[model samples]
Target: MNGPFPAIAEASATGETADLFADIRATVGVRVVNLVWRHLATLDGALPWAWAAVKPLYLGGLPDQAAQRFRETMIVPKLASLAGDAPTSVDAVLASYDHSNTINLFALGALVAWLRDEADGGPPPPHGPRLRAPDVALPVLASEADVAPETWALVQRLNRLGDTAQPLILASMYRHLARAPAFLERVEAALAPVQADGFLDRAIAANRAAAHETAKRLAQAISAQRPPLADKIETSVSAFIDHAIAKMVTICRSIRVARGQPL
Candidate 1:
């Protein structure tokens, strides 16, 4: 129920850990390292070990493949769509959010798959096509201090939208979207019905199951390539992935629901 392990601030990252942060952003094709990796970096040797274990798969395109498969396999209920008369700016903001979420979910899913194998003593997955990170710009994530007062208040409100009592669980998606206050408002409005009608819960459940199956398939493919790690490290990695995956599913589904996109 509590947030996953406290993430070391990017400002404090140094040496190999800092390098890994850069590599993760580059490899994952995103501007910011998701909170999941930042939290994992807090553990002794966990970040490097886990990154190394999954790097081959990432470089080999297994993550892209898994993400594609996930997109195809998962489904969710359609809700009342955003109005056709919505402004161009609103459409642009939603498009940006959609792109960012789509890129993140699959790559994060790959990391979860590799970590699951390490935790369960499963074999490594096979390599696929060698690929490079895409050349696209992601939105700048606004720090709490930098966000406008109104936007910051809305961020707080959106963070509290879910049923959970864990006040510390901040979704980076909102922080990133804060740059567009109107967009955030649209998101809040779109998600209200899903939350009220309990579709958000159902969407989260579907995402969780999809994440699990994605990880399972990845583990089977890369089972033989998993590197050795201490039992303690493995346990910690497993726990972190479990929490991260669930939170990830929640955020991913929430965004999809907001956009009236199929989960």
Candidate 2:
């Protein structure tokens, strides 16, 4: 279906509110649930393939029709959603494309991992793969097609969210995404803002606190040590305690955010 007029669409998408993280988290939660709603209409399941075939043409390259159905079914809906009222970075990237498009590896991976975790009764997996789309086969035409304002807006929001949530996503991926590079990029990008805000400082502080606690435990272990096993026991207990504390910090990280303090 045709969307709104260009200018109106642009205006609707271009609200430059500064605090998007809170907005996005709320939006995403709602949209994700909405995607599963039975009443919502479904897009063509095979359009993903059509986008892939047409992608190169927009870039001044030729077309390839293989894998069309998959693109139509999955990729199109995902992209269209991103272009919807509540957009994400993933949506922004897809909207940059013309008719030609393909499956998003990073997004696909994250979505899969998220779904898996949801099914398993846990939070979404954090770490995964780095997302990168090279210009490998994309041949640009002589004429420049301006990306839709809505698409660009979503891109900006995604970029913003990426900046904030990347690290947490990374940590989550390591535990969940099987160490895929695409997932890692999404995690990194999503958490980009977090990195900018020096969220790592919290992680570091948490680590240091853990280390100090470990050293104290080691001292205790040494005081209680007997003869030949004293040094070994102290070292083992110290290392074990340190590792444990570091792990504990991950749990605390989210708590700070929940409390609205700087992480």
Candidate 3:
């Protein structure tokens, strides 16, 4: 199935596009532009307009606080005890996934909330306690030619983890972590039990619902500071927010299950 927009590959980016890529990574504390931004970059004037609208919120700490608030407020199931001791590598992989998921979920959630408010013709939400973005070294997105064959195959498999009908959206998380095949393998094994038991499905649904609600509240909190977005840019940003939030749900579920959490 064809996606709505093609991702602008980092290798081919130039001038403004390349600069935008760097800014996105630096601002969001990520190594690569997540699929949402990459897809936005494909649309004429969409990426810049959308970024301008949300840059202040991201930089001013609303996103980080929103994320922390989510973690503090949401009620998630407890992690099941693993049958055997996990290796240090497994722990490392889980930590990496957690970091990436937390950052994306909050930032994307805030953006979506603001977009929703804009669409609904409401005042922007008020701000919460400001917090600095976490300092974490994110893994670089691996080029296909640079990755080992087995690892690349594993990345493809991981990307399709939750598919049943439509094509599963490929998450940047897997591609970024493709550099560590062992880590992916361990994560896959750790999640196998939850996947088989249908726990992963429940977790994904829960995360998606929670994200939507969080976005709504965040939008209300930051409504007063909402920026003016053109119709074309609004439409593009809205679509990106929808897709990105859904993907973030999947990423969150995968991270939870990988850590032996229940739905």
Candidate 4:
């Protein structure tokens, strides 16, 4: 709100001509406000797509079907996506970006006002959300070598979408990866003392042993594919191996608790 809203509102208040461009921007702005409100209702840590979604709303005029598409695709996904990452302490995702609620709320309000102006035969204004920092690059999924095979695959999917903002997506990736063996290895490797002490080394070896056992059992099940699996279980064993490795990383990470914590 304070970021872009007040300036836009002041411009609207002070402009001599109620032109079409301004009006269109105003319309798009209003849609943005509604989006922010809905974002609040679906509160969690910031979404990867939040900023990207805003861009279309502010820069491109809200199409007639925009809300419907949003309801079906985005609204439903939000329920499942935030299962592990919602911020219990915070009420808004915008706060994660260091913006005060005032600025966020206001920017959206001004955009709404502009939209109303457009509905009244004001000029068709500029539309679509503007990225605050256009120079910021999207985050890439780390390679399989860097991350567990499974986490790498999921992260790759998320990175490819490019629909979400980089930081938000990365945060989610990290949050979920936090539950994977791949993340733990990265953490342990980062802390030399932890490794030198053998605390991390022992833990990693033990976890790997368990994961291998599980993968072997899972592989057997897949190969044993009974009548139901007859020609239907056409997936390659290699593919299953990769998936199993990834799942193992995720499961291990999920059950992991930090050391040096009070019991």
lDDT of 2 by residue, 120-211 (tens): 23332222232222222211111112344443333334333312322211111122112222432343444445446755445534443533
**Candidate 1 vs candidate 2: which has greater lDDT?**
1
* Cα error of candidate 2 at position 210, Å: 7.4
lDDT per residue (tens digit) for residues 20-118 in model 1: 999987776655676667877877777787777666667777656655555565554454554444434444434444443444455455555555542
Report the lDDT of model 3 for residue 124: 48
Candidate 4 ranges with C-alpha deviation above 4 Å: 1-172, 175-192, 223-256, 259-263
Cα error, candidate 1, residue 142 (Å): 2.3
The root-mean-square deviation over C-alpha atoms between each candidate and the true structure, in angstroms, is 4.9, 24.0, 4.9, 22.0
**Ten contiguous residues minimizing lDDT sum, candidate 2:** 75-84
Which prediction has more favorable lDDT, 3 or 4?
3
Per-model TM-score, in order, reads 0.72, 0.22, 0.72, 0.21
lDDT of candidate 1 vs native? 0.59
